[model samples]
Target: MAGGFTTMKTLLYRLFVLAILLSPVYTSDHSAMCAEAATPQTAAQKQKAAAQAKKKKEADKKRAQKKKEQVKKQKAQQKAAAEKQEARAKQQEKAAKAQAQKQAQKQEEEEELKQAWLRQQAELNSSTPKKEVVSLINIGAKFGYAGIMDKMTNNYANISRPNELDNDYAYHSLKGGPGAGLSLTYELQYGAFRFETGFDFTYLNSTSAYEFSLMRRLEQPYGGNYFYITDDLRETRNAGYVGLPIMFGAQFSRYYFMAGAKVGYGLFGNYKQRGRYDIVVKDDALRDPYGLGIHDVPTLAKDQRKLSLQQPSVSLCAEVGIDLDEWLQAQPDKKNKKRTKPGERLPFGREHLHYKLGIFAEYGILNTNKPTGALPLSFNADDPYPQQTNSMLSIADTRVNNLFVGVKFAIQFEIPGKVARPIPAPASAAEISVFDKESMTSLTTAIVQVKNTGNNRTIMKPKTLSKGVIRQRAAVGEYVAMAKAKNYYPESVAFTVDSPGIVVPVKIYMQRRPVFQVKVTDKETGAALAAQVQITKRNDKETAYSMQTDSVNGLSEVMLQDSLQYALHIEQIGYEAVDTLISDIGDKMHISLTPIKKGEIFVMKNLFFATNKTRILSSSEEALEALFGYLERNPEIRIKIMGHTDNVGKDEANQRLSEGRANAVREDLIKRGIDETRIEAEGYGETLPVDTNDTEEGRQNNRRVEIEIL
Candidate 1:
């Protein structure tokens, strides 16, 4: 940018210098031309000059008239061309609209036919019964091998035993045991997926043999050192548990797969030990310094006792199986005379049975670790008392987890839950037609609601008319038919069907409803803000009609009543809410909301208190909840409640009443779990008046309670 500026400045300087140099020449040339024109003329020259001027005036007038005529002719041609173009555009637009209407009519007819067919199929399904049997309750039995996984570890060590180190050992091996359970599973199904969960009396048992030895140090005479070992020659742990399994699986044809977890409680446990060991003593000055001390002469020292196991053990199991009942059900049984078909339930006192055989595997994911109350032994034959040499020890540990992998066989009884049979109907058909009165055309895609008014029951759900007609079996009755569609007013027609063989035509027309839209903006800044809008029918107060608007654009498409008037209510926090009446739907409406500023008070238009009391009315619940939600959203903001009354009562009574009302609002908010420090309450009675107290409207305005943002 600097270089460009410098270059531009240099060019401007050169141009200035050039203009200065050419100034003298320009002035000298101008003066010479003036001197030549100032020279005097004779009488003959003057006469020639006057004649030339007369010719020039006539030429100038002719040229001006010619230019004006040319401009008028060009404008006339341009206007004619513009008119032609506009006519062509109007013709094209009319053709396009006609084509679009034709296509829409065709699509509507096709949709009407599809909807009619679907309605007929639904009615038929509802009237018919199933031919096959579905299982409602199931009872089964399952048995599998339970493998005890002994993941031995010393996560906890004994601080009392100085010679024993807990973590210096490892788990060698584990073994599997027999397991069985009685299952009573109730099946919950979702299409092809099935979930099974129930109580089971499961007996889970396993045995584990592992090696985890502890270290011990022994002191000899004459400042000597020695070592002792509490070697586990052969140790066995057995445990039993009762478990509950909740499994989910999917079945495809005859094959299935399942995966889930099982929770169990420990029933019993047994711990057994059989081992022998010797100690190695080291001394430098004595005879036979590398002495091999004999501990109990390597005899069999058997210790068998009951072990305590942790409760509520959890494991995950998976299964894959096939239904054995499918093959059995496929076979023919000549003994049963009421059998209808293959895979069908037989009549009379007969029940269907299903059998399943599957392989399963379960692995315990939690650690069941506890201490074994055994001690490391030290032998000293040189001591006077040989029997008192060994003492009870601490600091040893063990862990036992479980894993089961085997096969399970189950037999389940299925009870049928559905009835399926066909019903007879009339062969002939009757027809109904729908129409549009505004366009004088057959209306398609308009749904028809059929009600048997004579019987006071709905004969059929709303079915769309196909090709502007509905064909169905007719009964000898009077029926009310209603036609409805989006953006169209609903119309109903009553007709009678005398017989079943003939086509009964009933036509109904629908009127089009106009679309309405509204755009909301801020009154002061003309900026858009999200506003809550509601439209309620004047006579029917039970149902509210409303639509959500975009927060950024503050625009919404609202639904309006057909002929009835409605109240449109729109509100935004920190602004005054507005209410207006809408007689009919029209173009987009532009509405502006007045924003409330800090320290500016606004009356709560909908909030009402009892007569001369502070208790709020039930109709004010929605307003209070909205206020609470606003406070929750704006945590840092604070507000003050100010109450006032009209000047009709005693001054002291009025002041006390106003104060009570203001304080009541504050107390209610505090009870709703809002912090008391963020709110303040005050009352001015009739002191700070908003309007004159002479008129009723002014008094009503003065009796309002207001809130000001602080």
Candidate 2:
């Protein structure tokens, strides 16, 4: 940027210097032309006219500036294009690389699995398989929450006998977190069975703190002195292990007998600092160690080395589960060869099997140096003696034992369809058509004639997308109600009976409706109206109603059967009638009908008023005859009466006239027994006009009163 700015400045200075040097030439030319003009030569004066010359100079400067701007814009566009192209190329390269890597990894795994399957198949084909007719796959979760894995160690804390640390040892259980596992299996000849394998891992980090009575050390010393732990030493089992267990089983019908072993080599097992040391030296009747020497003498203290609680280890287990259902399925009779087709696959019908729950038990063989517990339970508080705070119990030298007990739940399923195949797809449309004996080539249909009777315009039109693409184009579900009466469908040839002979004919529907559905309204007032809407059809007597416009939507659609001279009428509560035919649809058919003034106001056709008077005259009885007819035709013709008077007399008279006229109309309507429940009357006296009141003709036109459909 700095370099560019410097270059620009240098160029500007050069241009300025050149312009200054050329100043004399222009001045000299101007002086010569002026002097020649003063000599009265009309040719010279015309050659350099002041206004023309000035305009030409300004135009030249403007042209130069515009040219510079164009060059700059072109360079900018080129730079942007280059950047965009580079970015696209890089993105494409990255995507290709990632796709290639993914494909390669998938292929590698597939190849490996393929090879393994081949090996299994070869072995199976070479020998008779050991058969076990059973079914069940049960999983279990074992939590090491109550027990610390055991380890056999030569540490001081592990003393077999309380006072015989040098002679023997004992082991204490380690405590930890929770763990779980999963299993898989299959059915065999005998009963229910499982080939289960799963993983479980946990961590146990415990804190130990203690306070003990200070005691004198070195008996008979010259000066009596009390001894205390200078620092805290802790024993924390923050170790963890992942277990892999695989078990096999056999089911004696309702009796499930299972035995499988799981071997898990210790992933990692170790101890951390946080526990104080515990010694029996002071408590022992003999204050000193026994004659036999032991590296760690018993002394209840908080200072000691954290025992190396870590060890590479291995363990094994066996478990069993059962299902209580004793139901046995009956065998199928052999098929008669004469009644069967050759090369037909065996039926091997689906198994409708049921299952029940049962109990389970397991046992394990402990290994490694730590004092591990065979069972997940503890005698009390998990420590046999949790009150013995951070003190290392003299348990390392003890003998360990195996465990076996407990019960759990189980379920079974007889898988359907070989090990894999699922339901196949149904026959194709063409095949179904053939079976039905219907024509493969069906008819086309349009929906231009089917108009939405919904009131809301926004809800009427299909929503188009941001880029103008219809993301969710309007569509009718295939479950359209089919009946014989008023068959307005199959507008275009796209929809037709695919089958004509068998059962009900199958019809093919189009993705998009072919008819141009229109919502008509008055362009001047944004109002809707009723018209003699026509939707020509090939079958004219199909009972199809020409006027589908309801109170909600002033619209009707058709397939555009013949000429598109569809009549349109703009009918609103106050506007006069407008009748026209739409022939030109420049764009997607959004036809707006501009209503020419048919009447000054919209008075209810069924409503009436006094003849030329504001009184509620009784003779105006039948003005609403047609209105009643309309109500009979449309049960929901809600209406209101609006009265207007021309500018005359005083403001109060005009107002009274307007109000009286409206009331008179209402009264006559009520007299005809039109429901007063559906009407309200309002008067606007001389406030609006049909034309300008500046002339006598315009005033006369405005002086008249009019009725309005509110």
Candidate 3:
């Protein structure tokens, strides 16, 4: 289009220039030649203009169509982008919601699992049946009397010379002496079963008596000689041994029994003997001739004998004992004393010390006597012939065993076991609080009892102070807390002491008991009437509470439990008595008593009867008694007993029932010491109903017995 426009402008410019040049050459005929030239050029220029205009129009139309297509394509791309973004956003929202739901479900499952675990732990803690096994080291001392059964036999052949001598010997009584021991034991205990092994040092002593006689002949210048000797010997023997004992036993409450074996090696032994002897000699050549001989001669005979105890001794040992720790130190004050701490040694404050008083026996299973052939007595004149004399044990031919039986007292210092140390468990602080459930206020006077559930032991029983809180230290375990106060129902709660050094809070809320306050007054004058008020549980004969209202105030108060019914009886001299069932107990009750006068009606509110019958039920005793007492106190007053019934049956039947019920009351009063003449019976049937017979309560009220004073 631009090139066509430029060509057209050049043609116009050349035509103008040719017209100017021809105007000068043909001035005379310029108009005629110009007109002809203009005509032809105009025709050609018009044709070119039409073509260019058509072409420009076509170009503009094409550009408009291309621009419209671009705009439509851009709008289409924008809509697709928007749709994609919306889809992505929706997907993100769905994923986020799913994730949130999954998280919530996971959290809920975790919570449920946690609650289940807590319940399981609580149940396990409450009913666990296994007792902990304990190991201990005990250092102890024991003292007792030790006696031995001695079996002795004399072998004269081993002690006497060839045929030149005569020998006689007898072994007499053997008596035991004191025995003392020290022990270090390791003990393992599981429930009632006990195992103990340790080292022990024991010392024992005994005394034995022996008698011997010897006669010998001597050759002399006077031809013959005779010698005779008799000796009594008492010997004391001492032995010390170091032993290892393997014991198995059981402990039952405060008593224990142990039976085991002790392997002991004799560390030392010694003996001493002292006594007197009588000696006489007769010679047939001189003394027989003179018919005289040496009489009794006393000579002191003393010697230290050698011990012949074997190297090693095995004994069967048994002990039956009561734990003296349960008795000797059973005093509460002693038990409450400060205990010795770990790694501490206190002379008297060791709480771990256990004492036992027992009867113990050790019978030697292996012969402890090792004898070398030697004479029990020495005839040599040399002062102390220690080598010639031997212990009676060495000369005895039979086996010798040791037996010790006596009361033994022992004090054992117990060392904490690796397992037992875990017990008497770690101490944790507990803060217990008591509050009134209704009022949400502290109960300062509440008594809080904390018990360890595992052991069923009461750990603390304390009355709350002004703060209504008690702070105490308790072992780490499950516990139950109970709170009680006067005029309040007791409350209990369960809690756990899980960690040491942290306070476990226990809150107990107690409900207050219902209180019954009664005021008695005269019906006419409203004057206070002193009355005897006796309250008993319904259907129970024993009085639940009894009190006398003062004449001045006519007030009596008693605290009673909820969800129970009581029978109330009130009586005053010269006034009608009241007997009623107290089921809906409120804060206060007012009673207006009518004086014993003519035509004053008193309803027996507590009286009960059998269904559809006139027979009085046993529950009506209180009402009958009240009426009887009122009649008795006002002896001169006569009473008329009237009965009424609800309209539930035929009129004739109702009338008869009422009449029978009234007569029944009269008879009961008569039997209870009221004069028959003083009581009259009448029936109103359904005509004199005190309340409507429309509802059950109204019907119940309509059926009643009333006493009329006359």
Candidate 4:
């Protein structure tokens, strides 16, 4: 074994050496194998890793691209939304600006109207008068006829027997004579009413004639005889009286009438008489010789008497006359050569001496005759000369009244009374200035007036301002200062004069009226058209101006307030009416009107109705008037009223509503004096639409009432 071991060792050594050498080869091979195996696996892993990395990179790129696309889309949406928001904000700002402008214009108009009214009132207060009472005295003289009226009755009888006859007679005649009177009167007059009281003196004269006769058969120693005697007398009477008269009357213009009572007392009366008479008698016993008798007889002395009047008289007196001063003043006074002040009276002027001439009458309403038991005629036959007496008034059994009628002349003097003193002007004056409102420039030619509001009297007359200013002296009171200039609105300012010497400064700003030329033309042809243009205040409907445009120029010029709103209406024959508001006066107005003809359609823009109903509102008056006027101007034209509605309700309901609206419009035209046959009504419910019904604006356009010429 040892040997074998040695041999094997040696062999092993060699084998070892060989194994070593092969080991290197095996190591190399194994290493190569491991390297090959590792190479393939590493290569496969590298390939798998590379393929995975590529796939992941591709997925990351795809995700990143998708995210970019999403962001882009989001950014696009944001841009669109921002643009929409910006557009909406711009629209709102534009609307707000328009509304503000409209409101400002309306406010300016109202202020101007108020200023005009104040100036008008100030002018009316400066033109009125004053009233007072007066006192006067009058002295007058009168001449007239005085008469005594006596009622007389006479009884006479005649008896005839075989041998005796007797007769008696008495007669008297009285006549009136001239009279004169003097009077002094005091008078008080207030406006048309007057009172007068006075004392007067009168003298009267009268004349009368009296006759008496008596014949009696006397039985003497001789056979039957007849005796007769007669007497005649004439008399004159004078009377004087004192009287007091009280009168109340009214004077109308230059004429006056007074009626009252006059009480009088008779002071004295006297009478005188002169004349002749005749008598005759016949005797039967002396028939053989002759029928003889006394033929003529007269009183031994002329009858005359004087006595005091015993009765007082009360009489109703009335007088009517014209103021002679009024007529005298109208006559030329050539004799008045004295220079007189503004209100001074001339030395013999009729102003202080009022002369009146009037007719007056007085009647005594009491009995003046005294009755005594004395025969009218008396005679004594025994004496050679028979005595006879006559009393005519004593025999009368009635009352006697005295009457006087006369023309009176009177002169009146007005007694000066306490004169009303005028209110003194203030020591200090106020400056009133007139200026243009827009330019703040002074107006030199502006008329300035200052009025005292307490008395409504003008403190200063309307006078042209000097250098746009006027100094006014006013009493302590409220006052108004008014200023006006040509082509400018009048203005008034109220101020208070608190003290007598306060110097107040008053400023009045006048606005210049805007003058505009209005032109009307045909819409289609752009040609001038003659039309009637009417401008009215928008608030009160008061017509401010009305005129017809010139036929050639179709132009009318008018003054308008820049601050006021006005309604302008233009109309012409065979043309559609134009109604518009004039809110701005920056330029001349150009109104274009469409011609009315067959197949022409016009929307009634201003027509308004009650909510959801066909009843017309009062605000629709202007529209209705325009339509009526158009129809009236063209009598031969026929029209159709068509109504439409938005598509918001049932078709049937909408149809009914549209029909009702159309009929309402038609009926309104008929009521406004249009012929019923000239208008026809129809409805198209949502079928014929002017605009889309989806939006609110579109729906509003679709719902309309229009007139169509037929």
CA error at residue 95 for candidate 2, angstroms: 36
Q: In every candidate, how many clashes are there?
A: 3, 68, 0, 5
lDDT (CA) per prediction: 0.65, 0.42, 0.72, 0.71
Q: Compute each candidate's TM-score over C-alphas.
A: 0.33, 0.29, 0.39, 0.35
The model with the greater lDDT, 2 or 4, is: 4
Q: CA shift at 293, candidate 4, in angstroms?
A: 8.3
lDDT of 1 by residue, 1-710 (tens): 99999999999999998897579887788788777776555556888988999999889988989888988988988988888988888989999899899878644643443343344446546645222324434565666677656543446344234445444553454566777766677765544577877766555565544344443334434434444444444444466667777988887767888899988787776644455444555455565545355444132232335555666788887989887754654332336533322224444223345667888877888755454544434335443112321111112444556776777777665553332111111223346777667886877788887888888787768887767787765567888887887778888888887643345777777777777888888798777756667877767754367554566787998556656767788876667888887667765777898867778767765678999898888877656665665566568879898899999899888898889988988888788878999999999898988899999999889997788989
Which candidate has the highest TM-score of all?
Answer: 3
lDDT (C-alpha) at residue 603 in model 3: 74
CA displacement after TM-score superposition, residue 242 of candidate 1 (Å) = 1.5
Ranked candidates, highest lDDT first: 3, 4, 1, 2
lDDT of 2 by residue, 145-172 (tens): 2234333345432122221222122223
Instruction: Quote model 4's TM-score.
Output: 0.35
lDDT, candidate 4, at 582: 83
User: How much does each candidate deviate from the true structure in C-alpha RMSD?
Assistant: 29.6, 27.9, 32.7, 32.9
Clashing pairs in 4: 109-563, 234-273, 234-274, 235-272, 235-273
- Model 2 scores worst on lDDT over the 10 consecutive residues at 428-437
